[model samples]
Target: MSDLVSVAAIKDLLTECPICIEHFDDATRIPRRMPCCVQSICQPCLESYSGGAATLSCPMCRRRHNLPGGVKSLPKETVILKTLDYLKIQKGLHLPCTDCPDKEIAVAQCDNCGTFLCSICLSAHKRNTVSKTHTINTFDEMKGRPLQSFRRLHQCSQHQQPVQFYCYTCDKVVCVSCTVVDHKEGKGHNVVSVNEAHQGKAKSINDVLGKIEEKTKRLSETESALQKKIENIKLSMKVARDDINKIFDNLKDRLNQRRTILLSDVEGKSAENLKVTEEALDSTRLLLTKVKSSSEYMRQMRNKADKVEDLQVMGSSKASLNSMLKESPQEIPFDRTGVSFVQANVQHLQNTINVAGMVRSVTFSPTERPNGIPDTAVHNVITLEPAEFPTD
Candidate 1:
C-alpha cells in the first residue's frame, strides 16, 4: 500500500496540463479544464485548438461539445474573446475563400466564442444571426489606395480624355469638345496649343533649377565654416580644463603646508598652558596643608602666652599663602592668523575669432566700350617733371 501511494504521488508531481505541458500552478479560477475522458488543460489553449469554433470536439473522447453563450453564462470569457476579435479585425486577418482562390470572404466574428464565419456560414451560427447588419469593408477598400487626381496640364477632368489645348487666360486644360462648348458659351478665354505651353514652362523650370544649383554651392561652403568653428570651441574647452587643473593642484599643496605649520604651533601653546596650571595647583595644595598644621600649634601654645608674638609670623605666612592662591596662571594666546591660504581669483580669458571685415567699396564699371571693344583710345595724356619740397 505504501509503494502504491508513493507511485501515485510521483505521478501527480510530474503531471502537466495537456494544453501547455508546463506544470499547472493552480486549477481553481484560472482557466483549467478536465476533459470528459482525458487530463486537464488550460481554457485558452483549448479554445485555440478548436479554431475559435462554436462547437469544440475533445481529442480524447472524440465527442462534440458546445460552449456556453451569453454574458450571463460566461461574462469574463466572453469579454476576453471579444477583445481578441477586435485585435484580429485590426490586424486584418483574413482566410482565403476555398471556392474562389482570388476572392477573399469577409468573416463576421462572434463576440462571445471568437468564432469567425463567412457570410453564408454565419447564417448557421445562432449567435452571429444578430450581427447581420454589422458594417464590413471589402479587402480592396481596406487597402486604402490614394485617389488619383486628373489635374495634369493636358488631361480633362470631366471625360478623362486627353486635352489638346491649354487655356492660359483661365489656367485650365481643355479638349476640342470642351473648347466648342466653353467658347460658344462666351467664356472670353484665351487658348494655346498644349505643345507651345509645355515648351514655355520647361524653359522656365530649367532656369530655376540652375539658380538652385548655384545657391546649393554657397550653402555647402557656409556649412563647412560652421563645422570648423564648433571644432575650435571644443579644443578651447579641453585646454581650459587642463590649465585649471594644474593651478588647483599647486594651490592645494601650498595650503596643505600652511595648515601643518599652524597646527604644530597651536599644539605647543596648549601644552605649555596645561603644564603651568598643573604646577599652580600643586603649590596651592602644599600651602593649605601648612596652614592647617599651624592652627593646631597655636592652640597648644595658648598656656605659654608668649605664642602671641608668633601670631605675627603666622599672619605674615597667611598673607603670603593668600597671595599665592590669588595669583592668575599665564595663558599663551594661540596664533591662528597664518593657518589658511587665500585663493587667488583666477579669471578665464575669453577667446574669440572675429571674421575678416568686408571691403568698404566694390565699384563695378565696364572696362570695354558699348560695342564690346576694349577702350584703348586715350582721350588725354599728362607728363610731369620732378617736384622739389622747401627746406626749413
Candidate 2:
C-alpha cells in the first residue's frame, strides 16, 4: 500500500499547467483545476493568457477545464503534502539547457520574476530583493515545455503594426492602428476582413469576364452575318445592272431603226414633189414657144391678107400658154399609214425598265386572318401610351 501511494504521488507531481509551463503548487496559487485534475495553473496566468475561454486545456494530460470564480479556500496540509511529494519526485529528474557546455541545467522558471534559472540560480535569484517572492519549478514540472501560441505577425506596410483587417479597394491587409492613423486620416480607405475581400473580388471578376466572353462571341457572329449580306447585295446589283443594260440596248436598236425609216420616207416624198413642179414648169414653157412660133409665121404671111382663121388659132394658143404659166404646181400627199416610228407605249416601257435596279417592296398575303378576324371587320388601329408616343 505504501509503494502504491508513492507511485500515485509521483504521477500527480508530473502534471502541470499548459499555459505558463509550470507546476501547480498551492491551491491558492492554482485557482483553476482542469477537469482531469492532472493540470492546474495560477489565476494570474489564466487571466493574462490570450487563448480565450474556448481553448482552456491542460498541456500535460491534454484535458480541458473551466476556471473558478473569485477566491476559494484550500486545505493548507493538502498543499504542503503535494509540494513535498513533487520535490521528492523531481530529485531523480534532470533537465539540461540547449546552450550550455556541461549539458546539465535546471529547467525552472519563476512565475512572479519572469526568469528562467537553474537550482544554483534559483538560490541566488531568491536572495535578490526583486525576485524573492517568485514561484520556482523545474522544467519537468510543467505540462508542455514548448507551447504553441499563435500571434498576429504581419505588420501593416503603412503603419508598421500587426495587420488585423483588410482593405478591399487597395487590396491589402491592414492593422487596427493603420485603420485609425494611416487609413482613416490619410486616404479614408475602406477596410474589411482579408478573406472576405478576396472572395467578393473573385465573384465580381468572374461575372464581368463571363459577360465579356458572351459579347465577344456575339460580335463575331454579327460580323460574319453582315459580311454575307453585303456580298449578296453586291451580287444582286451586278445582275440587275446587266439586265437593265440589255433592255436599254434592245430599245435603242428599235428606236434607231424606226428613226431611219421615217427620215427615208420624208426624203422620198420631198423629191417626188420637186420632180412634179419641174414637169409643170416645162409644159408651160413648151406652150409659150408654140404661141411665139405661130405669131412669127403669121407676120411673114402678111401678104396673104384676110387669113383671120389662122390668126385666131395663134391667139388661142397664146391664151393657153399664159393660163398654163399662171397655174400653181399640184401638192402631192405622201402615204403615212404604217409609219409610226415613235411607239405610244415606249414611255411606259422605259418607266418599267428604269425601276429594275431599285429596292422594290414585297407584300405578303396573310395565310390566316389575324386573331381569326375577317379582314373587312378588322380595323388596323394602334393604341399607344402618352410616354411611348410623344406628341409633336
Candidate 3:
C-alpha cells in the first residue's frame, strides 16, 4: 500500500467540487442537470436558487428555465455520479479505516476479512477470538498493489463474506455462496475475477479523463481569444474617440471662421451706411443755411429794390432747396441684410435637430454599446459643410 500510495497518486485523488469547493464525493458533489442547457450543476447551488417565483437561469448561458415541478424534478447527471465514484476509488488507494467516520488512514489490510484497518483496529482485530488466523498485510508489503482490489474488500450483505467474484450478467460483485444460488452457472452467469471487472472500470475512467482534457484545452484557447478580442475593442474605442474629438475640434474652428466673416461683413456695411448718412446730413445743413441767407436778403432788400431783383434771388434759392430735398429721399433707401443660421440637408441631423443651418452631423457609433449587439454593427462617419439658412 505504501508503494501504491505515491505523492502523485495522492495529488490526483484530491479533487474539489466546482460549486462547493469541498471534496468531490457521493455526499457533497451531487450533480443535477438543466434540461435546456444539459450541463451539470451542483445540487447545493441549485437548492440555493430553486423553487422561487423567479425562473432559474443557467449559470453558464444565462438562459432562464422554468422548474414548475420544483428543484427535485431536475434530472440527475449520471456521468457526474460515475466521475465521483472513480474519484472515491482513487482516494481509497491511500487506504483508510472502514469503521471510522474520521477518515483516519489505515496502515494495513486484512486478507481474511477483506477490509483495510487502522493501527488500533488492526491490533483489535488480531486480538479478537474468532480463531485469529486472519492474514494481515501492511501497506509496505504490497509494493506493487493492484488497482482493482480496492472494491473487493467489501463484505456481501447477505453472506457476511468478502466479495470476490463479479457476475457479468448481474453487473455486480458476489460472494462464493451467491455464485451457487442467485448467480448459478445454469443461468449462464459469466462470473469473472474482481481484477477484470475493475480493470474495465479503470478504462472507462481513463476515457472520461481524455474527454475532460480535450475540453480543457479548448476552454483555454477560447479564454485567450476572448481576452485578445477585449483588448482590440478597447483600442478601437480609443481611436474612435480621438478621431471624433479631432473632427469636432475642426468643426468648431470652421464655425469661428464663419462668425468672424459674418461680423466683419456687418461692420463694413454699417460703416459704409454711416458715411452715406453723414454726407447726406451735411448737404442738407449747407442748403438750409443758403436758403436762410437768401430769404433774409430778400426781406431786407424788398423795401429798397424792385420786384425783378427779389425774384432773381428767390429763383436761385428755390433751385438749391429743391436739389437738397431730392437728395434727402435717397437717404431713406433700404437694402441692408442680416445674417442667421440655416439647416443642412444631411438626413441624420435633419431628423434630430429642429433648427436647420450647417447641421454638421458627426455620425458615430455608441461608445457604450447595448447588450446583445455585436461589434460588427458599430459604424462612425462624420461630414462637415456650411448650408444656407432661411432668414425670418
Instruction: Give the candidate number with the greatest lDDT.
Output: 3
Worst 10 residues of 1 by lDDT: 352-361
Tell me the spans in candidate 2 whose CA falls farther than 4 Å from its real position.
1-165, 169-177, 184-190, 253-392
**Candidate 3 segments whose C-alpha is farther than 4 A from its true place:** 1-18, 21-111, 114-131, 137-152, 168-170, 177-190, 253-392
Candidates 1 and 3 compared: the better one by TM-score is 3
Q: What 10-residue stretch in candidate 2 is worst by lDDT?
A: 334-343
Q: Each model's number of backbone clashes?
A: 0, 1, 6
lDDT of each: 0.36, 0.39, 0.47
lDDT tens digits by residue: candidate 3, 1-392: 11111112211222433334455444655666554322345667766755454468655334476877766577554434433433444444555687467658787767776576788888888888962678887767644454323223355779987677777687667889999999987899988767666566445433433443444344344444434433443343344345434433444343444444434443453445445544544434333332333233223322222222222223223333333233321132322211222324324432433222321212222245668878887533333224545342
Q: In model 1, which regions exceed 4 Å deviation?
A: 1-155, 183-188, 253-392
Q: Give the TM-score of candidate 1.
A: 0.26
TM-score of each: 0.26, 0.25, 0.37
Q: After superposition, how far is residue 346 of candidate 2 from its true place, in Å?
A: 7.4
The residue-by-residue lDDT of candidate 2 on 1-392, one tens digit each, is: 11111112222233343345465554334534323221234555654542555344443222344544321221122222233333533454544432235555656666544344666776777898877776765556654322211011244457666565666455455778867765673576888755555456545433433443444344344444434433443443444345434444566544454334334543453344335434443433333332232223223222121122112222223333333234333222221111111223335655533222222211111234468686786333332112211122
